[model samples]
Target: MSDARLANARWPDVKAALESGKPIVAILPCGATEAHGPHLPLGTDVIISESIAAFALPKLEERGIHVLVLPSLAYAPAEYAAGFAGTISISMDAALALVLDIARSLKKQGFAMLALVNSHFDPANVAVLRDASETIVREIGLKVAFPDFTRRKLAEKLTDEFKSGACHAGQFEGSLVLASRPELVDDDARLQLPPNSNSLVAAFAKGAKTFEEAGGPQAYFGTPAGASAEEGVASLDCMSDMIVQAIAAQLEP
Candidate 1:
């Protein structure tokens, strides 16, 4: 197995690893503490992000990439989900600022690359991360990348059992949580919320209503009835593969 210490490693050890010329890649898992129906845990974003990093790190290390998985950023810009219970969201500005600072710190630390594994679907925050990445690359000269897992192609690769647009606390997120943390999922508590039939892409393109207005009353937009651990595992695997490919493409040579 690869030797990538996550929570256990201290700064001195990390610095020593860097000094030894070990190929190191820092993985920052970003998530939100929000309501995910009744079944999934409030920290769904945290679970997915950390799971992806944990599962992918060893694989990357096998390819000569030393990994350092950071703790998940549990507070995301989730104003839409804030209407629901257990949704603890941060402002877009604050989320962006925090991520930017983290990116800058990673750059200053002399890490070879930084990968942000984000699980939530906050478009505003995504834009913030994208802009921050650009700024870091341009100013601090850091090599960073955030893969877009929400793409239809990646989602399809993750699950064939669910229909498209079944995101949020629906089959996609529900199933993922089941796969990663089954104990946290309570099937009886699951609820099927109305789907956002409008085209998300179009909405984004047109700069339509904010996420809060778009998600509607329940603060969710998908069918949660079909969620299963098996499906979740498939989705996680697909996401891991995508992340691996992204890291291979973006990290410095």
Candidate 2:
């Protein structure tokens, strides 16, 4: 295969893949244009989601699944980070519509399934994905596979920091970015930051409306200073497996 990225592939290649007699899967990496603390770049979610797709490509291909990675959906409902600058939060309705439209387009082209590799876990954003996935399967009749890591079964497979529910720009996410896009991380800022133990999950349960209300004044939770590239690579591997397994299950006869 040339490249699994749809943006880089010509139309002829896409057409050929659809005609190939093998299951054709389209991957949409869903992320957000929001703050991720001082050290990590705003596009951290995009980077991680895309990285998961990259890691899963070979595994997916090994199973005779033809894959095409759609250009990442970088904008999402990031209401919690709205207080921070550069955090573009879209409405849940808008996000849902966009995802449905993308799925509709792929369905018309004879795609077997659409796999959503999402790294942004904002509550509203997660809702949008859940709703969109259901709508895609119910209305469009397109097979949709989404590994919602927030669920206990999936969350338990991730890092301890992620399970702590305090992992925003903390060790869990920071480590993923470090492993994939190390150049984007501010080494000085990362090392100078103190640990934040505030659990966003706990705060949300208490009806906290924003990062500030959640006790993340710096828009961070958990221990960022403790993040390591080694842990990041490991996290990606685990996440990639999740994506592959979810898609594989949906493709089952």
lDDT of 1 by residue, 67-91 (tens): 7887678887876566777888788
* Among all candidates shown, the one with the greatest TM-score: 2
lDDT of 2 at 143: 96
**Residue range 68-167, candidate 2, lDDT tens digits:** 9999999999989999999999999899999999999999999999999999999999989999999899999999999999999999999999999998
- The lDDT of each candidate is 0.72, 0.93
Q: In candidate 1, which residue pairs get closer than 3 Å at backbone N, Cα or C atoms, i.e. clash?
A: none
**Model 2: what TM-score?**
0.99
Off by over 4 Å in 1: 1-6, 152-156, 160-163, 191-216
lDDT of 2 at 248: 94
Query: TM per model?
Result: 0.86, 0.99
RMSD of each: 3.0, 0.7
